[model samples]
Target: MVSIGTAEIISTHDAYHSSNWPALKPSEKKEMEKRRRIGSKPPTCEKKCYGCEPCEAIQVPTISSRPHLSHYSNYKPEGWRCHCAP
Candidate 1:
C-alpha cells in the first residue's frame, strides 16, 4: 500500500493499478495521470477566473455550452486556477 499525499492508496491487486479498468486505453490513462497531478497543486486565490481561457492552455479547452471555469463553478473550487493556461 502506498500513501499519496494524505490519502492512503490501497493496492487494488497484487500490483499497483490492478483495479484499473481492463479496457482503459492509453489516451485515457494519460489524461487521468494529468488530472491526478493537477489536483495536487496549491490553490491560487489571487488569480482571476479562467473564464474558459484556461490557465495553462495546455489541456482545458473552450466549450461554448460547457460551464464557465470560475471559482463559482460546480465542479471546481474557487480560487483554483484553471488547468489550462491562458
Candidate 2:
C-alpha cells in the first residue's frame, strides 16, 4: 500500500519563480531530500488516467518539489525527467 499525503505544497506554477521563492537552507534541503527519497508503491489508478497506470516516478530534487508536466498526458508525467512522487 502507498500513502500520498506526506509533503506540504509550498507553491504553484504561477507563483514558482526561483528568485522570488525562499531559498532552502542546507538543513531544510537535506530534510526535503530525505522526504523526497522515501519510497512507496504507485497508485492503483492515477487521478489523470482512469484506467492507465503511472509509468514512472522521479524526484525533482530542487528543494521540495513535485513533478512538472511539460506536456499533458492525462495531466501526469510521461517520459524523461518526470519526477513523480509515489
Candidate 3:
C-alpha cells in the first residue's frame, strides 16, 4: 500500500496478467514502506460495496501517478476487501 496525498491505496502487479508492471519510484516506494511500517489507518477505510448500483456509480475523486512508474488502483480504505470471489 502507498499513500498518495491523502488516500492510501494498494499497489500490486499481477504477473498472470502482464510482466510489464511499472516500478515504483524510490521516494514513493520509501513513503509507502514508511506507511506500511507505521501501520497507520490508511487515512480512509470504507465498506466494500458489492452489487450496489448507486454505490458503484458514485466515484470519489482520485489522483493517479504516471502509469509508466506507479500502477496503483482499487483503493479500499483499510478494512474493506473485494467481495468478488474466485
Reference-based lDDT, each prediction:
0.53, 0.48, 0.48
Which residue pairs show backbone clashes in model 3?
45-77
Ranked by TM-score, top first: 1, 2, 3
Give me the runs in candidate 1 sitting further than 4 Å from their true place.
1-17, 38-86
Task: Write model 1 residue lDDT over 1-86, tens digit each, in one string.
Answer: 88889998676454655656586689998987788775545455334443644444122334435455454664643232336443
Compared with the true structure, what per-residue lDDT tens digits does model 3 show for residues 37-71? 75333222234445433232222334445554444
| Among all candidates shown, the one with the greatest lDDT | 1
TM-score of 2: 0.25
Worst 10 residues of 1 by lDDT: 55-64
Can you rank all candidates by lDDT, best first?
A: 1, 2, 3
Highest TM-score: give the candidate number: 1
Model 3 local distance difference test score: 0.48
Runs in model 3 with CA error above 4 Å? Answer: 1-19, 38-86
Model 1 alpha-carbon miss at residue 70, Å: 24
The clash count for each model shown is: 9, 2, 1
